[model samples]
Target chain A: MTELKLDQALIKKVISATQNGLPICERPYQRIAEQLGIGEDELIELMQKMLSAGLIRRVGLVPNHYALGYRFNLMTVWDVADQSILALGEKVGQLDFVSHCYQRPRQEPDWHYNLFAMVHGRDEQEVEQQVAQIKQLLGDACRAMTQLNSLKILKKTGLRIRS
Target chain B: MKLSEQDRQLLNRVQQDFPLHPEPFKVLSDQLGVPEQEILDRLRSLEQQNAISRFGAVFNHHRAGASTLAALAIPEHEIEEVAAFVSSFAEVNHNYQREHEFNLWFVVNATDQKGVEKVLNQISATYEYPLLDLPMVKGYHIDLGFPLW
Candidate 1:
């Protein structure tokens, strides 16, 4: 069960501390708790609470895609039927290679990409093949598609939330 | 550096359903038949190798703040200069160059919509390029839980 209401202050503290990572140790949360001056049990309880509330997406390892030999990151966008997005989006999101998928606003005139999914692979061909598979899955419902290959990483930082 | 069988397994296992305990490492050790100390050390070393970006909670941006995926068609000549200016902002996280006329794309997250707009306006004015602020209308596949192996 999720928390009825999240404790805002505690959420900020836990997130800020673990923003970088949960320090690798015998008792990682315990170490963080000691710094926060809360008991290990309390820290764990708070973490569990946040995790349940859907605030914390996942409490686990995030392997660097590039390091894992997933050098190709294609920002694949599709113009799918608006009514069918909910049903179709969930299916696409479930794909193993598609790391992130969302239906974003369509900036008309210049941009009309609504459904966005991040496809990752060891190389461009692999990524394209995956995209083709998605295209096959989409069938006629899929209008236009574009594969935006990442050229360079100008910056990479996590989202900061201040309470 | 090649990954040992144990390392590969650990990497695959930790991607999803990681243990939730005072000593999660102990749980991993118990399951994998490895020492808890080794689990911790291996994770640390993997992190050091930049293989594991981090082992922690991923916050939901929609719940926590106002975020948008904005793109700018920066002139080829001004790519470097423009990228520097955009990446300078703290709110601007995950900036990257893509192969397109509307080349540079970045995600901006702020505490509120006002803050998000402020960043968008600044970039729009500075670069003199139309910024396509494409905020998520519906989130279908936000979770990226999958097996690495």
Candidate 2:
């Protein structure tokens, strides 16, 4: 992986951009450039560089799960056999319903699940039913768990490069 | 390193909500007293520079009527095929590969219990393997936007 060497100015630009994007107008980028007193091309070039270096994961829209009515969201874990783990992950990732998927280290004796995915549903029962299908598919090798929300959301944001 | 007064004003307007109006840009232009074309140009530039990812809406799946979210582990070698297969379903949103034991993970969102079951069943029948459905019992925080800087 290539290292992202970002300077204070670039970092500040990114911060400002994310925190306060240009107003919804015809020439948002032009507005940003004027604000920073930089050429539009120069600003764009820097962003491309950052993206190539993995400093920026994606430039797209993020939908709000709750507002859209996907109230019941759960994080699912699985104990996938080593042989088929990658194929299975790829397949799951391609699913439209899945928002996030990742492999995290298991905690201890209680946590044996190595594979993890998140699912959203209308209610708990609906989520449970989905789990049942997954259980049947993985058979004995898979142990699934569903966690419910107990409190209000605290924070949800992406990485902030230090300026 | 320096920002003009107009830039500061524009940033302040969009920090929380990018307008939801039908001509959001027009609304912004009127508020900021800047030419509409200027705002549009600036947004394009900001996007090109990776300063702002994009001006888009965030959807809440659960509230939208989706009923389930789950993940499964697949062997490294078979990840490509499985991911392709799972992604084929309209209900499956997207998947991610993380560094962990159950390396392969994905999400499934359906309208209801039956919807979840149908998608899961389809995956099982196609792959001849079971899917582990770990539903979110509690959500601490799930925001995708971050401070770019």
Candidate 3:
């Protein structure tokens, strides 16, 4: 699809309208459109434009991984040689068990990790095994690694924008 | 919670994509070979069971607005007070106390980069702790759904 200029006003309205999940009904889109004071086709067209513009990632069911029994979700950070980060990051991202992977900036002295990957598993052993695979992939390039296990959740409301 | 084979299939299907049609659930019903009413019922039940947290659009925060992953090192005794203060901001979402020296980690999101910086600066000034602000340099993956067997 060709790149299209997004209408910010319409996009904001659509996001504010659907941020709290779509209504579970036969004509969900139509209902949302009606509430937003637009026709169903117009609403869908705006959504399509946003999706094409990479504003909306996906429209789907977001599962609660922890509630689904994948109890251990660890943010595994690795400090690998700068030269090999791009290659190693690609390999680590392809792992079925690694849901999110990115190369973030490193805070020197205090933080040396540049590669971050999120590993999910049913138990500690499973998470450890997954982390081991990443370690093995990095091999000599990986100088240090740490698993940040969440001890407590202080807040967890997903992304929101003021209407 | 024990998941039936059908439940697993439904979960796997919906996570990948949801149709953007007048009757979106009905499209899913056709694809999954389950009746429309039954699919709706299953989704409602799964949400009630907390298996499905949300069933809608997942916006790309970086594209829609601005955000960054930030962490602060809070003294053990003062974690509670520090966390409460940090969580008071509407822009601070997904705050957690992790097992690390940089214990208190959270995501700050706002409509623009200036808004995000204002929140972070305010929080930093409020507390006299070391704050590490890390933003994404590159992303290797996007919209990859988890597969449940």
Writing each residue's lDDT as its tens digit, candidate 1 over B1-149 gives 45777888888888766777998889988998999888888888888888887777788888777899999998899999999999999999899999998999999999889999999999887779878999988787675455665
What share of the reference contacts survives in each candidate?
Answer: 0.83, 0.07, 0.82
Show model 2 residue runs off by greater than 4 Å.
A1-12, A19-22, A124-126, A129-151, B1-149
The model with the greater DockQ, 2 or 3, is: 3
Evaluate residue A13 in candidate 2 and report its C-alpha lDDT on the 0 to 100 scale: 60
Clash numbers, per candidate: 0, 104, 0
> Which CAPRI quality tier does the interface of model 1 achieve?
medium
Angstrom error of the Cα, residue B45, model 1: value is: 2.7
Per DockQ, the best of the predicted structures is 3
TM-score of chain A of 3: 0.93
| Candidate 3 total steric clashes | 0
- Residues A35-144 of candidate 1 have per-residue lDDT tens digits of 88889999888888787787778888888878878888889999998887888888888898888999998888998878999888887789879999899888888899
Q: Which parts of model 1 are misplaced by more than 4 Å?
A: A1-4
lDDT of 2: 0.53
Each model's TM-score?
Answer: 0.95, 0.48, 0.96
Of candidate 3 chain B, the 10-residue stretch with the lowest lDDT total is B140-149
DockQ, every prediction: 0.77, 0.05, 0.79
Tens digit per residue, CA lDDT, model 3, B43-133: 8898889898787888988888888889999899999999998899999988999999999999898999999899889988999899988
Task: State in Å the error of residue A143, model 2.
Answer: 4.6
Best by TM-score: 3
Q: What does candidate 2's lDDT look like per residue over B1-149, in tens digits?
A: 23346554554466444543445677778988887789777756554544453463333344323445444556768767876777666666555554444544556666456777888888877776445565543222233332211
